[model samples]
Target chain A: MDIDTLDLIDQYLRGNLSDTEKEAFEKRIAIEEDLQEEVLIHQQLLAIHEQEKISLTNTSYQQELVQMNEILNEEDNAKLSQKIRAIGKNQQPHTTVRFKRKKTVNWFYSAAASIVVLISLFFIFNTPKALPDYYQNYVNWEELPSFTVKGDPEELFEKGEVFFKNKEYKNAVATLSIIEPEDKWYPFALLYLGASYDQLNENEAAIATFQKLASLTTSEEYSKGYWYQLLLYLKTNQKEKALEMKTKILENPNHYKYKEATELDF
Target chain B: MENTERYIQALIQGEDQIIQEIYKKIYPKVLAFILYNKGNEDDALDVFHDALMYIIITQKEKRSVILSFEAYLFVICKNIWKKNLKNKVIQTDVLTLEEKETNLSAFILEQQCFEFYIAKFSLLSENCKDILSSYFNGLSYEEITLANAYATVNTVRQRVFKCRSKLIELIKNDKEFQKIIKWGA
Candidate 1:
């Protein structure tokens, strides 16, 4: 399509055209098959502009699930193989084949039991220990350098910090998010904002916030944003993503968490 | 009918108890279907999980469903498995992350336009991408101008028009896009 047609379509899609122009465009669309297709494409693009972000979050969520399934599969298969070997040793070849076929139901029951126990143990043992160290070891709000801002923006940041310190994370998110990205405190606000999202169990939002920090900042906090992201992935049990972040952090030794990332077991 | 909506809500919210119930209810049939279709147990598990996620995303986007949830889910799983089979014939390696996104989204959408649009969008200049994203995200032309440090609303509007034109041109000229339109038709 020509630029004029494209411009016209853009105006129409945005409802920028006058009523007469819209009527004319609609009439043209009715008669021209190619124009109808172009309009359809424009509509799809407009609809999808917001969708891509959600799609990405959903994809991340799916990948985490897929990775969990792989881990479960590995453990389950190992147990099954061990059981099959044990059955083989105890029985004749013909009897072993029969036993294997009959034992499928029992195997599933045992696997389910194992998974439940494993999950219980993970929550009981791992969750409490991992989070404090992940947050406390790296984060010291008092030590953070204050960014230069004044008046309403500074007051907003102070209010946000108060909410954060009081553990009112939802309020903190709502308050902190109002600070403009161009403000001096924006990056630091993002740090708190991301942590608040993490506390709220909004993993995708937290990850995206940290990502915005990594991309938008140029100071030491740029790498610190990524470090926090690595920690968030670990907290969420997304080992694959944690490992991916670890690689990115370790790529530059000067990265704020490079040494800490190197010490990670994964 | 209530069960259908409840199950879909469970999927959307990632409610573990209900999601577990869903798995227990659906896995046997999914496994049987896959095994009958020459897939192994692992493929069944993978396809089942993929289908669930696909449903979650589609429901989030579209919010309207005609079929019952289980039937909708099963159809998606079957289609994904069949598509995977075709891909396996062409390449022995497993689908890469991008290929998986393209295929899964394409299957859910019943068209390949999602990936194509994303690819075209990525090829634009970063300024264009940012301006368009802000615009499409419901920022006013004035808001976009302020955010991007453009001189005026008119400048932002012109930039958006030019960038969108470029994006459309890129989409319209792509050979794969033509194929997608034809295939969808």
Candidate 2:
């Protein structure tokens, strides 16, 4: 209860109490509830950490992490030393593929300067300045044949055909989507894209795409895909639509795609 | 991204960036824990090599879905050091352990628990670890005595008893053990 007793108890818990003091403390602590509770809580709190001394995870990895840091620090220090050595040495310029943005302020200042000069020129010589070709050629590509369809679509479409044959729907879709619209194989790309979508279980998207191909009625590719279009209808349980496609295909007896159309059975 | 999941996916996809990121982030805590446990840099090297190898092996052999690669690896490294300590001549006594109950992902727990005794034995005292390791290897005391020089069978008996008690004490005091047992190795 007294300060000396408290000090004795603290010393005892630390295993530093004198033998005589320990004896007196034991006699008092025998019936002292508060002192016992305090002792217990103190020991518990102390032991709690000791208990946690065991590993939560790989102890070595943590050690390695530390060692790794030391190694990295050493390496960084070495690099810094190298940089110091090169204090005034010659260096080669490095050009990385970074986005180099153009300054926009020149447009306003240059335009104001040009307008003033143009007013002077008009007063002096009665001539007009011609605008640059950037805006004039914005949409026009007739002179640029490279931008036009270069017939890669036919070759790519053949690859898509291979994918379709293997039933790789997504690959076929990807292979077909890159085709240029003006390529001879463009019609086939659209048709196969529709079939690929259908295989991927994208019914509505496939149907809408298929309808676009069907609207280009002049293409033989559209005629060939009529069966799949009908098959799509049947798959979606659109019986009326499937039958209508089947009837149209059957009615045109001389049509090159009629055989494949009838064979699908709608 | 969950570091473990990110780590594995990155490794599988050959993404060096993720690998470097994870390697940098978690290496410290692991190093500190191991160094405090009487582990040297060599032990660290072995622990990391073995842990990474195990992760890759498990991933390839079975579709391992590790959510926390760091946690999983930490457990492995700790276990390996413990096992090595026990198997080697060094006799260490484990008395108590404390653990926090963090609900780590299944993949991490499973990876940690998979054949963890290697690490456990390493941390045990030289005598207890040898006895336990021998026992685990299916060797009887007779066989052990035949292999090694013990005065009598009673010595082995006392050793095993003391060792088991010590192991129990170590585990009981270990907080990591507390967290891990709930997940159950």
Each prediction's DockQ against the real complex: 0.08, 0.03
Error of 2 at B51 (Å): 40
The candidate that wins on DockQ is 1
lDDT digits (tens) for residues B1-185 of candidate 1: 78888988876665666766666556545654664466665566667766776666656655754357777677767767877786688887776755655555545544235656877898999999998898777688889888778998888877888888788789889876764454322
lDDT of 2: 0.49
TM-scores for chain A, candidates in order?
Answer: 0.45, 0.37
> Once all C-alphas are superposed, what RMSD does model 2 give against the true structure?
26.2
DockQ of 1: 0.08
* Residues A1-266, model 1: lDDT tens digits: 67579768878988899999999999999899898777767766776675431122235445544543443245533343233223323221111000011111223233223321111111122334554445434444343333323332325565566667777775566556655677656777888888887877787878998998898756446886788788788777677787888899999998865776776664
What is candidate 1's CA lDDT for residue B185?
Answer: 28
What does candidate 2's lDDT look like per residue over A1-266, in tens digits? Answer: 34445335546766777788788777776788666544543333223323222232345434433443343235533343233223212111121111112222223233223322111111112343222221121111111111112333223445566666667665555456655566555665676678677767888867777777776677754654455566577667677787787787787776534764554432
Per-residue lDDT tens digits of candidate 2, residues B63-163? 64445677777876676565555545553442221110011122234344333333454568787777865643546668777777888876775675566
Q: Write down the lDDT of every candidate, Cα atoms only.
A: 0.64, 0.49
A250, model 2: CA deviation in Å?
2.9
lDDT of 2 at B127: 74
lDDT of 2 at A17: 79
Write down the worst ten-residue block by lDDT for model 2 chain A: A139-148
